[model samples]
Target: MENIISDATRRNWDRLSASTDGKLTSRANKQKSLKKIIPVEYLLDTAKIKLIEKICESYIGYSIPEIIYSIAVILLQSEGICERQSVQDILLDFQKENSIDLIQIDEAIPRFSHNEDFLGALYQSLLSEGDKNKNGSYYTPRKIVNDMLSEFDLREGQCFLDPCCGSGAFLMGVSTKDPSSLFGIEKDPIAVFIAKLNLILLYKDIDFIPQILCGDFLQDEVFFGKKSSFDYIATNPPWGNKTKIVSNLIDSKESFVHFFVKSYNLLKNRGKINFLFPESILNVKSHKVIREFIILNQDLNEIHQYSSSFTGVVTNFISMKFIKGIKTSVIKVRNKNEEFYVEYTAFQHTENKVFSLLKPQEEKIIEKVLSKSAYSLSSSEWALGIVTGNNKEKLKSSDGPNLEKIYTGKEIDKFRLREAKNYIHYDRDSFQQVARDEIYRAKEKLVYKFVSNKLMFAYDDTSSLFLNSANILIPNVPGMSTKTVLAFLNSSLYQFLYEKLFGELKVLKGNLMELPFPKIDSETNNTLTMLVEEIISEGKNNQKDIDEIIYNVYGL
Candidate 1:
């Protein structure tokens, strides 16, 4: 379809919206509001004038919603497809509405038909964002759908499904010669109507007809009757944030996991399921159980992740594929042509932790360090700073008797601290969530940028308070002192290990706990402590001295 909508009938379609003056005001609002839950791509193309005319002939005097629904029912029934009893009941309810102005299908059909997705685009412009979020409905972009189709080679006569088929984009993307074997299941009545229309038109040129059932595919009935029903399934299920987990096995309460489990159960033994999911599934601690299940039971294929792939939504996205009954043995990773392959494995030993995957040499080096005496960074004394319930009310710019100098992540660098930008009015009876008050009052401590792109820690002997952004850490390692631990954290080798083990921009405590710290001898620890003193006294950014000491300590 062409991009531009010719001026001949744009006004009529625009005026069909709610605020516009019209005799069919209430009915127009219903159609406009219905647009939010229905994705634009799932709606059938309205550019075919002849197809529209033929469809309008049978619905000459029906209401807009009724006309569209009736037209779809006629097409599907003619192709020998049956509607569920519940859907048939919905059609019965549509017969009772007496539309104020019965649509003049002959006169308006031409205006509604355009060179683009005329009806879908028109509905999107008329609806609001709040309406779109009503049902956790988000239409997949064109390029994203294309990329998914490219990854799978659909063979003729293979049974396929879009379990949550919104407007049938996946079904339409499949250009297989046989549409008779294609299938889909959708719970939304409006979406089911639109999907049927899309498939009807898509298969109009061929002898094939698709079966898109209007029912929930996760029901026990579906499992018993339709188990192992398809060879391929592609869908973007609803991410119901407010929904609670019905099954206790899933650690997280997200609705996507339920959809994945249901879809997997319905697939053939060797079938593949491709989906677009929230990025949290890859590394979030809450999803560790599901991650283990997929890795152990399924042949995890590939993952393409990105931040903010959806224009209006703030969540990150990842595209992945899973082949049923296949366990991953060999894994490789690389970022080629902007595609990042997420591989969290190296050598024969690996952990189910975020960013644990490393390059060959990096794995060898970390293994060598672990082979010797060492401990996890968790053994160190660490405490998060005070989280002021209301920073504006509790924080003061000028120093007072009770106010203590505080620093944020921005005021700290490698082995040195910068000038204070703010101060916290500390009191025993203050409105602060003091997690570790003793750590806040300690005389000698090490502080690092709580939210840093890299490891940035500095030493402070004065008992200074810090904001939550600059967390405090005091080492309790038997052989290493506070200064030695600070040097190791700020060294180049530790920074490299950190980035390889956990690539998160924010240096969360979990990332710190995962770092493998080597137990250096007394001489090595003393040398690192002396280098730390030089870097702090001179206030220089040079890290070569400290880095060399860390390298020798690790025997790198």
Candidate 2:
């Protein structure tokens, strides 16, 4: 056992160094060298396996041994030594050989190293499987986490926990600040071990055993037992429809709802929680439970929004810091140097709010706007938009032959809009007509559907509001042609309003109605309508002429 452990350790060290060297070389040479040294059948005996697991866990901090083993298996898999199934098979075989009187693999899976190796492997696997639609496991950039931590004045002795601790990045980060203060809970045993390994490697002096528990956080009794135990909780929870787990026991959405309630209960009064959540949670009807809970119980201190459309696969990520035992109101923070101030208004949608380092002049403008308008214009009308529900039906060519020309949000790239070459057209003319009409209505419940011969699009949901690269299409007065609305919404003045009001983040639906439009008379609106018709005519005849017309109208 000792010999095997020593040999395995030596081989692994050599492999690590060699892999590093391979990375510094050409792809072909790197592959050639990797193939020679890292073999598929490099087996470690029980003693070696236990030793390596302990070493990895100690190095990383607070993780399970099974997760360490899984990571090693994945690392081997990445080098083409073993497949996922093969790794699982080997682990099962190892367990059976020892009569299952060993470390619990189920518990260990969640404690995987939160280091680069575990994260990289998980990321690659997620990407390969296209798990975004299902799991919503987007990696939070470390810089953002550091920035968030710097904003708050955290002490060393304060207890910290990350409920949705993915690979324990946030917990590992906290350990860097003060290892003794950190604790975490993760459902993924592999991730828990990774996090544990990472913390052990970084914080050698800290002796407090990591308090990470592996289980469904929503259903787990462990999280519920401690009320207000943690001083700080930081996590970038999974976003969108991804990361949803379906089961016969409980619904995924319900689980999230429960988690939010539980989180509120867990934090002590005045305890702070810095969370990274999808912007949809702010205004989406489905998240009413969470929204109401925060509003009723916690004080919303700061909200920093990033441009959603610009963030590919990570749409509308907003960092929010909430404190318990404080008044339930929205406080806006511009920067670390400046203190947060409360802005009391019914229209203040915390989700649409953004923080920035403002100059004196910008601050004055903001003050003026806030003084006059107690609430955003869309406070009343900020309704959730229709869900396409299932795109497969609407994306099929056989259903609708001319559906290829329509556009969805995905087709809108940078400032340029691309026509969708593939789409589903509805056979029922009545259904198509209803969809088209609904797409244009003032309180339209359109499901991000593509419209034929229309370059403009309107969305009621706040999630779809912000324009990342350039201008986005918005609705004008009802019964008016889309061209007329497009001409004005796409104008430089409107663009300037968006820039001034929204900072870097995209303007959500709630902010859309508040956007001050150019005071054009009804007669001018008619004129603009006529101009757009002429441009459309010219576009059909000569695309270059249409471009020139658009340039002239927008003065771009």
Candidate closest to the true structure, highest lDDT: 1
- Compared with the true structure, all predictions reach lDDT values of 0.62, 0.46
lDDT of 2 by residue, 413-461 (tens): 3123344444444333523222232232444222222222122333232
TM-score of each: 0.77, 0.49
Off by over 4 Å in 2: 1-67, 70-133, 138-141, 151-157, 175-180, 206-208, 224-228, 241-261, 279-298, 305-316, 327-556
Task: Write model 1 residue lDDT over 384-474, tens digit each, in one string.
Answer: 7777778888888888786778787778877888988787777746755665667867877998886677888889887787777788888
Model 1: residue 69 alpha-carbon error in angstroms: 6.2
Q: Which portions of model 1 show Cα errors greater than 4 Å? A: 1-127, 206-209, 223-228, 306-308, 332-352, 355-373
Q: How does candidate 2 score on lDDT?
A: 0.46
Q: How close is candidate 2 to the true structure, as a TM-score?
A: 0.49
